[model samples]
Target: MPTELPMFPLGTVLFPGEALPLQVFEPRYLTMVDHCLAQPDRLRFGVVLIARGHEVGGGDDRTGVGTIARITSCRPGGGARLLIGSVGEQRIRVDEWLPDDPYPRAVVTEWPDEPSDVSDAAAGELTDRLAEFADLFARFSVRQGRPALPVPVWADLPGTDGDRGFALARSLPIGAIDRLRVLSAPGPGDRVLVLCDALADVVAALRFRLADPGGAE
Candidate 1:
């Protein structure tokens, strides 16, 4: 069954188990936050990627798939704005988009990943690919006179394979579209595969940049 959820369309994608920190200055979103805080048990909202517009002022095209963000903390920010701390809890598929009375609203259904076995080999490959991508990205950053990016420690990742896969996807230095592809994957196995493919693309791009220091491709 589809349920109505307050929607927040951003320029970036949020995957499950990821932290979402937002500065709410707009009147519409502030109202939405107030409403959520009023309902202690239902302090959550849906976050979708803004496919064709800005995050503020309205008139944005949003994607149908999104993640549920659970509010963990809220406080005041500079000059009438709000500081919200939330975490992505689950995936949701928008069934229908309703009028934005004060804020965007959508009728959505829970979209859980399908059950699938993730073999040891597949998991190993994902780990290897992530490491390779990180190394190459660090080198690329250094070559550009920038500091090397911090890499996530494998041992510190989630214990479960599924959770770990989502974490890996979140750590990738890829664009929103590629991240969305990982978020939309059917299951853990498929998500890992998509992430690996994205990592490969990033690695290839980094290598080309490193080789051709000043030449434009």
Candidate 2:
């Protein structure tokens, strides 16, 4: 069933279980936040990555896949502004884009979660890949003179394969496009596939950096 959902087209992608901090300065988004807060049933909005143009004046095109963002906190900021923190709850696919009545809206369909897609083998592989990727990133940071970059420990990650997958992917040094690919993936297994491919290239670069004698080892 197609449902109309309030959308916030942004320059970034929101992954399920991710926390995003937003600054509400624009009148449209300010009003949007007010409306969301007024609704007791759900203080949520949809966030999609802008395909073209900017997030400021609203001419930007956006991708169909997005995540449901639940408002966690809303604090008063400098005059007419709000500092908001939201956590992604679920994924949704835009069936159609409706007119921007003050704010953008979409006809959306619920994106189903298929945990079974994340097989035992895939989960194990994802965990291993995350560890290697994290290690490489930490080393790469050290080479760049940022010695304080924390190395990710596998045990510290979320217990579920799905949560761990999003957490690791979010921490990657890859570009926004690759991150969207992971966010829009149909299931956890598919997200891992895309992430693994990107991770391979990143890890290779990190290895090359560490190999150079001039670089910090």
TM-score of each: 0.90, 0.85
* 112-201: candidate 2 lDDT, tens digit per residue: 656536666765665687678778777677667786456455447776766766887767677778888888777767877887788777
**Candidate 1 per-residue C-alpha lDDT over 1-217 given as tens digits, one digit per residue, 9 for 90 to 100:** 7899999999999999999999999999999998899978779999999999899999999998999999999988989899999999989999999999988899999998888767777777877887887788777777677888677754468666678778877877889999889889888888778877888898888888878958232
What TM-score does structure 2 among the candidates reach? Answer: 0.85
State residue 114's C-alpha deviation in candidate 2, in Å.
3.4
Candidate 1: residue 150 lDDT (0-100):
77
Per-candidate Cα lDDT values, in order, are: 0.87, 0.81
Q: Which candidate tops TM-score? A: 1
- The global Cα lDDT (0 to 1) of model 1 is 0.87
Residue 51, candidate 1: alpha-carbon lDDT: 93
Worst 10 residues of 1 by lDDT: 152-161
Task: Give candidate 2 misplaced runs (Cα > 4 Å).
Answer: 119-128, 148-159, 208-217
